[model samples]
Target: MFFRKTVPVALLAASVFAISTPMALAAGKGEMFMGQFTTEHGTTSHPMGDVHARLNPTTHELTYSIHWSGLTGDVNAAHFHGPAAADQEAGVLVPIDGPYTSPLKGKVQLDSQQAAELEAGQVYVNLHTQAYPNGEARAQLIKH
Candidate 1:
């Protein structure tokens, strides 16, 4: 009877400890923030498919990935729009992968400050193709 009671208690304690461990760990336990957007040229409505950004918690460095099949015309510029929500106005936060042509690929590197915004969920990713030339896709960065 004594052995049975002690074993059960020990197991319960171990289980509780395991459950709490992930939350307490901060170094390698950072999260990924993600979002996406897309647009075509000469159209007020920008809706293609979506784009994504995978960000590292500790470094703030980011890898931007975009794929909006519906985007057309051409792109002019792409940037990080900030401090706002979708359809809620626009703010300049940082820059995306860039110096784009067309038939774009989905990858770019962000600097330190841009990475900081990414961790804070304040930054957004924008893409411009030769067709749109202004901005064809956009996605906000948020902890995922």
Candidate 2:
């Protein structure tokens, strides 16, 4: 009786661990980042937008999706600027390839420094329009 109960309990525990291990590993495989854009965050007033990004640390690939509307004018340019605080500005770390329309989505591989800055929450997305050549809206990426 003792041997039978021990075998069943051991098998059950092993099965539970096997099922849960992959889930735990998958959860830890990547990090998510998000941001909300507004004229308030930019150098000029225009409109609002938002971004969602995922970073795979092992592969150093950053995938992102951005959406916006009602800006002062058409989008002239967009970029990811980094290694700076929210109130400060920095040079572009990544240039968003265009048509420069809304709901932009893409992926890029990051260098070590860029990956570090992104992971540290020192990165931001900026949208520029014809009216606000500097920036129409901005959102700082925050890790989740």
Candidate 3:
């Protein structure tokens, strides 16, 4: 299998996505999740979108997929935030190191503690950037 570490950046991103297919098939179907984020703009106005996710329990990792319209800028970063409440979601558990392209794709490698947070239903994913000083979009996560 070609991991990002073994390939050129362009090739790496491609392979990362390609590898997921079989890995997806081998593992039990991951839980499907969806969320609505208020965003830094206050979740009260303008345009926004949803977040999609799949968790690989065995790897203790989560794939966050974000899609939005009228996003002010390119996606600068993505993250998993939480330890908050149902409508009061909190901080970030993982900082997605990215120069993310559209769809703002990335992987979050969770340690035992992060995994625990997710299983506890206290985690979510968010998209951030310059234009979206607060946030461009967000999706609160829940196991399906």
Residue pairs with clashing backbones, model 3: 38-43, 40-134, 40-135
lDDT of 3: 0.71
lDDT of 2 at 50: 89
Task: Write candidate 3's Cα lDDT for 69-144 as tens digits.
Answer: 6566677777788775566757778887766765666777888787777777787777776766556676667777
Instruction: Give the poorly placed runs of model 2, Cα more than 4 Å off.
Output: 1-28, 40-46
lDDT leaderboard ranking:
2, 3, 1
Q: Write the per-residue lDDT of candidate 2 for residues 56-141, one digit (tens) a residue.
A: 89888889999998687888899999888888889899898888878899988889899999988899998888777778788999
Q: With candidate 2 superimposed using the best TM-score fit, by how many Å does residue 93's alpha carbon deviate from the native?
A: 0.5
**Backbone clashes in model 2, listed as residue pairs:** none
Instruction: Name the candidate that leads on lDDT.
Output: 2
RMSD of each: 6.1, 3.4, 12.5
Give the count of colliding residue pairs in each prediction.
Answer: 15, 0, 3
lDDT of 1 by residue, 23-75 (tens): 57753554566665644234565556444556665565555555554556545
